[model samples]
Target: MASPRRRAAASPALAAFGRQFRRYRERAGLSQTRVAQRTGKTASFVSQIESGKKRCRREFVEIMDPELRAGGVLLGLYDDLNGDGQMGFPTWFDWPEIEIEADLLVTWQHTVVPGLLQIDGYARTFLSTDEAVLARLARQEILNRDVPAPTSLIALLSEHVLHHFVGSQKIMREQLEHVLAMSEVPHVTVQVVVNEDGMPAGNGGSFVLASMKDRSEVAYLETAVRGLTTDDPQDLAEIAHTLDKLRRNALPVGMSRSLIRKVMEEKWT
Candidate 1:
């Protein structure tokens, strides 16, 4: 028999389950706070479960079933995790089915731009020498996709993010030019959160809010520790509120583009 599928698979399934469960919960009008109270779990525990950073216990699923009332789906996922080894998403994380059909992606970059939209040089600078190769190979695959959706990306970059040059000044200059070039893509909207604005973004950490099919939204957050994925309505709502604030504090699109060009000129010279 095929070796039992690894726990890496379980993690993603559980993660997906949390996402869908939250959607259904919102549809059924149950708040996350309410779910936490009913399940006797902390809100952070609930968040971690939804984000797939923590393994959700089977008993908790059963307890949450009628409370969230998902017709037994989330409980079923918990049962599925019983036999596993090496839990967590593998490197080859396929886009969640929902994210593949996203209508818009609003993202903030405190240190660097998101990989999906990064230039090869920029991506390399952000990653370690070991990770850079793998990331480049992945980008090549993404670019090769035949029916890649007309992805709409609203990218916000911090002024400090640009100034903190990762690679050599030469590479950094090229990367800035690359960013300016990406701005010309019809579906890309680029903005810079200048330091003078004095707004604190990325304080809660880096996150991406993607608008998916049927108006579904997914949030992705990353820290020094790990990557987090969630489609929970409550979590998404909170993240969206934070992102909206960042956007308001960010420089206007034209100004950001000009700033990028100016940076390129200054550095390239």
Candidate 2:
């Protein structure tokens, strides 16, 4: 039997924690300031904690038990929220929302090409099951919706990804043709990282830097083991710097287009 596939969302646990906190507070008839004063914390801190805008500390959890009078229920809730938020998302399902709101999306694909730009057949091959096909199709809707499109969508794929076929030769050929067609989109830029050049990014792993509508950037990194999402400027800046170095080593846009064309020709022949 196939394992049930899952759609990813940020920790529903954190979301749950927020709901619980608000429910308990209102039930206790305690204003936000009352909770703060009782717990010896600031009103703003209490507000942020309840709203899931910030993480709770062990100290905060301890105070909540005595102040909320729920006999450690609130602390238990805090323990549930202790996990990394992205744990709620399935293996590679973390980037679509950021992509939806991106002003520009710069990606470096060390292994498979990022899913958004993959052809239908290639996506299906990577998934290899009906459930994943549905998930990928839903993700495709992010790009399809008539929302304001990203100002730029740059994809830098390793040459190895082009050389390998995820599915049958026919599917591969069709996929490559689809890629060529996608290259024609005015906002898209595709480049290949050839083996002829020394590795510039030095295998730090694959990552995406999405410049959001607010002009801030978020970064996502994925491996077979897990996925990580972060909007921290420092972390995103470092990843962006590495991707920049890799882009420098990648084939020029025109040459990369020719390479994709050549691969498609050889496949069809």
Candidate 3:
């Protein structure tokens, strides 16, 4: 069986820790202030961790576990959320709500079409199973949601991606057509980057940066080993700069559409 693809969200374990921590605090009859005082953290920090707005670090759990009389329960959950000195990102499955709630989503897809724009056939081609394809499709609804209005997307792709064959020629043709139709949507802009006799600057990998309505930002990067989601100011700034450079090298909107059509007609056909 194929290993499950990682979806960007607050990990269920992390959310559970938040819920359990809230219960332990309330049962002890202590306010967030009391917990913060005992842990040498701010009341806001206590609230955010308990509410799942922020990740509860191991040290925070170490201090709060004894202070809150949680026995080993809170520490255990923290360990489950983040095991041993490893990098902390794979376990977050909540709170940032990066994809679904973003007012604007900017994605760089070096290999294939962005998930939000992929047709079911093209998506399933590599996803290779119903369950995984469904997950990708579900994420796609984020771009078409009604309650908070549809998300605006700016997708930057490599010229190579348009010509790459994901499946059969028929599937490739349909996928390009789908991309073209989506590009016509009022809020979706698709640009292709073309550099002759050389690879583009971002060829090292593809990643996504989401700008939230609250003026905060988050970024997601998928590596061969794991997926990383971060809101760290400095890291986000670096990814933003990288994205800006790629956009600068990308073809204009009209030229990009023409390229897509040209490739679909000449190569896929």
Candidate 4:
């Protein structure tokens, strides 16, 4: 039979978490079964978790923290890996961490510029609070990291998003200029999706998918009220399909850059 899959396949934080958990268990003179019983989980689940073949939530780590005498180390590791959700997203959301661990990130923006590529000026237009903008700027630091290799981004922004005015004219121009500058980065590709062929836009919603080293993907779906973050296989499949459709109708890299430049000069000016 094939071996079970590993959840912490390439996440450094996750790997470290599993390693530290094992040390704590061993130090406490407990077997996996004993630990599992204490934590109200099956022995197999504990085994899988310590072996890096399974994932756990912050709550699980919280349980393990006191039980294993880890104090707060386990909780800290969990926070480091899955993110603390300080980005105005759901508590269960793994966004910036997902972005950091992902080998490939695909974004479809129907209205605004993709967050990762947005300049401070354009981003402030959407964010009402200074704290929120600071959170966004902090996440952007991942784009600068080289240790785990930069995340390759394929941004498919709708053409209308470019034409629409956000904030002042100067801010809009600056944002597109930032977009163009970032597109020149080797790992980033910006594509403008022009619906000349009239393909349905999945109700003009925006979503992002991060493809990790283990080939598992996470999706964040944008809604009016609040964005939804999901890892459900079916939800990922549908979102992936929609992302593919948007990509198919997108302009080539060079042409997309050209179009962005044209719009910035003509409309923003």
Candidate 1 local lDDT, residue 81: 45
Q: Write the per-residue lDDT of candidate 2 for residues 144-187, one digit (tens) a residue.
A: 55656545778888877777867788877777777778778887
Q: Residue 20's C-alpha lDDT in candidate 2?
A: 72
lDDT for model 3? 0.77
| lDDT tens per residue, model 4, 1-269 | 22322443433334445667888989988898887787789999887787557777667787778888888877866775567542122343346767777788888888889889888888898899989888888877667787877788988888888988889999999999999999999988899988787665655488888777887666778888877766665776677667667767888999999999999999898
Per-candidate TM-score against the hidden true structure: 0.62, 0.66, 0.72, 0.72
Determine the C-alpha RMSD for candidate 4 after optimal superposition of all C-alphas.
7.5
The whole-model lDDT of each prediction reads 0.67, 0.69, 0.77, 0.77
Lowest lDDT sum, 10 consecutive residues, model 2, at 1-10
Whichever of 1 and 4 has more lDDT, that candidate is 4
Q: Roughly what TM-score does model 3 have, to 2 decimal places?
A: 0.72
Measured by C-alpha RMSD in angstroms, how accurate is candidate 3? 7.9
lDDT against true structure, model 2:
0.69
Question: Candidate 3's residue-wise lDDT over 53-119, tens digit each?
Answer: 6786678878878777899887876775567553244453442356776778888888888888888
Per-candidate RMSD, Å: 13.6, 9.1, 7.9, 7.5
